[model samples]
Target: VESISVKKIETVEEFKDLKIQKSEKGRGISLTLPPDIAICEECLKDLRYKNKKKYYMYPFVACAVCGPRYTTVNALPYDRERSTMIEFPLCNEDKTSCVKEYKDFNNRRFHAQTFACAVCGPQYQLYDRSKNIIETNSIKEILEITARRINSGEIAAVKGMGGVHLICLAEDDKVLEELRNRKKERKYKPFAIMTPKLAILENLVIFSEKERELLTSFRRPIVILGKKKGSNDGILSNQVAPGLSSIGVMLPYAGIHYLLFDFIGQKSLIYTSGNVSNLPMGIRNEMIFEQLKGLADFFLLHNRTIFQRCDDSVLRVHNDKVKLIRRSRGYVPEYLPLPFEVEISGALATGPELNVTGAVLRRNRVFPTQHIGHIKSLETFNFLKNALFNIKNLLQIEDKEIEFIACDLHPSFYTTTYAKELAEKYGINYFPIQHHFAHVLGLM
Candidate 1:
């Protein structure tokens, strides 16, 4: 391993003397941008602690090591000004002392770009089917009322860090059946359920230590675990996973999720991506409501904009190792290293049409985009295109440096067509890789 010399500065002046050197033209090095981190234990404690006045019950509590990274980022060099959090400016001195916390090195939120308190940060609001806001005294009241509605077997479109989720009761057969019927596209596919705690999930699914670790880890990906023998009898409706022996489960990852659980009576609730009939998941407020019409009885939305539409990541543990099904949300914008240096200076690969994720390779590291569902429709195709553009922008990879574009061999595949278009636009070479061969190459 190549090691660089290290030095410790004893004073502010000593630290101030340090300067960052710019990389050579067309060549640079950086750490892979992190995925959205789950709410830390300290942050969770501050949620209810009386002394933490500004943070008490605050839904947007975040520190440098936690909160959104890829999903909220518009452009990068990764700073507050380049993120969606820019909309929520720091509170006035009278309401909160965030600026002080930002400057205080001893504070957990020191220099946190997404730092904010209830007074100045994003706020949640409940909306009826007619798009009328259901007035509530505070976010707590909103959560309580939302939970009550869900408990009463009503469906709700709950917006989270990345995209909207269609949530409902997991234990009621009638409710599950109705949800399946309403969300016609996913009639028989298993729906992932979110639990407040690990104990509740343990009682329903049989999981290994590895699986448990994944469930509680900072990434908080949905872990598919085998259901215990009587789990489907009553606790969880059989319809939750249809006839499958395994079920996908995830724990509360955000402050809103944790707080909402405080008011929910059930051990778990159905939390699936909010999309209908093969379309992409919803992110924008106006687009979400219209897209999910009649599917959701209410909407538990937030004022914060989602700069990127990311869906919850899904994975499973086999032989004590984690196997990812869909990689998004908590595991994106991160570069995957190749053992050997790449011959090309830079290249972009547009994955197959279904369950696709585009990739941009520079030198030896490949940065994969978040899960960009089916590319059959123009809307979804544009989502993939934008995702590719964002990653390239973040990496500062100029079009001139992209030597080649890769795609599936199928001529009619939308991704293939897009890859050709990109190649033509940038005057780069395009390579059509055989579909199955691409999977084998991934194994390499």
Candidate 2:
């Protein structure tokens, strides 16, 4: 591979002077990040070997193919310094003294990015609904307590990959009722349950071979699987599926989630966004208290501040094909190369209504933000606005330098409205692309 180095530019003037060129004599491969993968076979073997120094019990063991992505990232270039991993500095002492060849090898995370261990990585904490500290520095003890409380029919707000999820034993009627009453979510919108693995899900859902494969895929989206005939009614109350024929299900996406499901003693558990219905998922403890005060009996939280809010992505298998209903988390931040590289520098794309996804265009690609959910509430709108700013800042683009702003033609859309306002405020040209046509153009 050919290499070139340029002085780092920290100012807009200096940034303008920098040039990125493609070699005239070569063809190269461009790889978008594999959407947050499940533990690969190599890493799984390393984890399963009991005698190995990095054994299966190591909760933080991961390879380049798997682990946290958009959730832990605070900015772009996707380096550790630009991510939440910056909170935990590298253990120089351990690095110098370690004898493991892999530890020092030029692998994916060998000075690649976002490397951490249980020793220096993020930690867990617990709190009551009243914001009183319950415990700290003990994830196992806290999870055990939370599981006990849940079994006793109490709701617990558990923080996970992207945002908080209110976890409850799926089979408990009283707990479901209490959760519904507390959150005032009386609608029949089915809750997504996290199964420990695909084997556990087969008992609850009658999945075709194709459906099973999609469910077990690396993306691990909340797949709307066909519920088994005469499945346990108490597992998910009728309220969970007032009119829908299927329920959403997903596998554990993080190591903590895997442990949580194991501790809960069930092969599966109810996992839904920890927020009032129609609002954004809770990202911080303070926000959780403000939004889910009476909704949760206790909080199993962590010290790591979520830099972004990504809801669980939803998908459905139809006619032997997987269709994405909501795209977030495991499938974001990676840029999509445009057919033609436009001159519009740092353009913001206010996505269409319903399953909204914002985008930031730079160079020859567009980076779509995680699913922002239906933009009907103030909370969702504020999230869109903040996400736009965050995307621009992370990409190191100034508002004044944004050459264009893109929005959907739907005038009724709040996102479109916001895009218009931003265009006016920034004195940039606004391009209103028809929603349907844009999708067609994208496919072409």
Candidate 3:
């Protein structure tokens, strides 16, 4: 199939029957599921493209090739009906012109399932801490007001593709201190900042060419880079990274983020996950309000549901190579091939107790989950279980098909105990591997 090529046809009607067939079980691998992609350059231009009136300033504007994937998908086959975008149906123009664009092979959005626009897509609205909505004239105005509030020292819970982010002015020490006080667990921990563009980042951070690539990459992970000599000359507050010499900085990845910067005067904004302590970041609207009740002074929420909670991935360039600090959002659900083929058809690895990301091995490929944070509390532990369940369902991996369940050697760890429980429930073999040994095996 890889070597096969299609012969040229004189007319479009000649290839009417040509189609992509679905992969059957044991025949081939399932369709590769991509992680949530950052907004593309064309879509960014469409935000202000006067001629593309439908998508003008649309925060949820997306096409077939880009936007939410793993985070929005609710089932296999990866169709719009099987994604969170199902509720937000296409508008008249989207159904006609946009649909035609997808049919056009030359168009970038050819056969794109996530096609959307302002008239018929998920919309954002600003709300107060008391759950009351703040009326606005337009979507652009809403973001402008939100930015003004954030700049005026108000914390905002901004809903992203996967989860909500607690946003505040990056250069306000008093605001940063208040955010720390509210998010008790983040007292000493550093917060990541989001810059509006790349030119501003060049003057603030000392990063290599490779580091710059990571910062502006489509995955858009938060890259840790050293600060310039006078980087903190009123641009960034000392409290951003505390004692650390490096700071986590990322460029605006979404349309909302870009629109927010359009109204604000700050060079960067503190963009940290909106969650308490060891719990997972909030995804549902009600859950977010409850989770970040007092922490966020205002809420910049959206109607689109985040099927899965994926935190921003963190990475750093060391010795001209990239090292993943926290892998999520842009990097999960993709398979990693093992060096040697194993006879086992399927296997499960319940990850460690902290910064956990479970893995499922199917045939020769190992599929790791999005970052699941610390699995210490019941909430986080359940989140891990659900994450594993979701990936398993997507891959159509049955419990009986799993050859073994692997866990940390430490018996007291929740993952270890869960592995044992799953083994018993599924009547499968279970094994324990030292945490460091598992890491070494992965690297090899």
Per-residue lDDT tens digits of candidate 1, residues 1-444?
Answer: 135798986765534332334323343644345788898998899888878788888888888788888888776556778789899888758624887777666777767888788877898889998899999997778888988898999999999999999998899988888988998878899999998898888789998777878889999999998999999777899899988999999998998888878888646899999998768888999989998877999999999999889999999887787788999988897778899976666789998989999999888988899999888788998899899888888788888989999999999998998889989999888999999998898898
**Could you say which candidate leads in TM-score?**
1
Candidate ordering by TM-score (highest first): 1, 3, 2
Candidate 1 deviant stretches above 4 angstroms:
1-27
Alpha-carbon local distance difference test for all models: 0.86, 0.71, 0.85
Give the clashing residue pairs of candidate 3, or none.
64-112
TM-score of each: 0.94, 0.80, 0.93
Tens digits of lDDT, candidate 2, 29-53: 2222334556555555654565655
Please estimate how well model 2 matches the true structure, expressed as its whole-model Cα lDDT: 0.71
Summarize candidate 3's per-residue lDDT along 135-175 as a digit string, tens digits. 99998789779877888898999998899999999999999
lDDT over C-alpha atoms for residue 350 of model 1:
92
Indicate the residue-level lDDT of 41 in model 3: 84
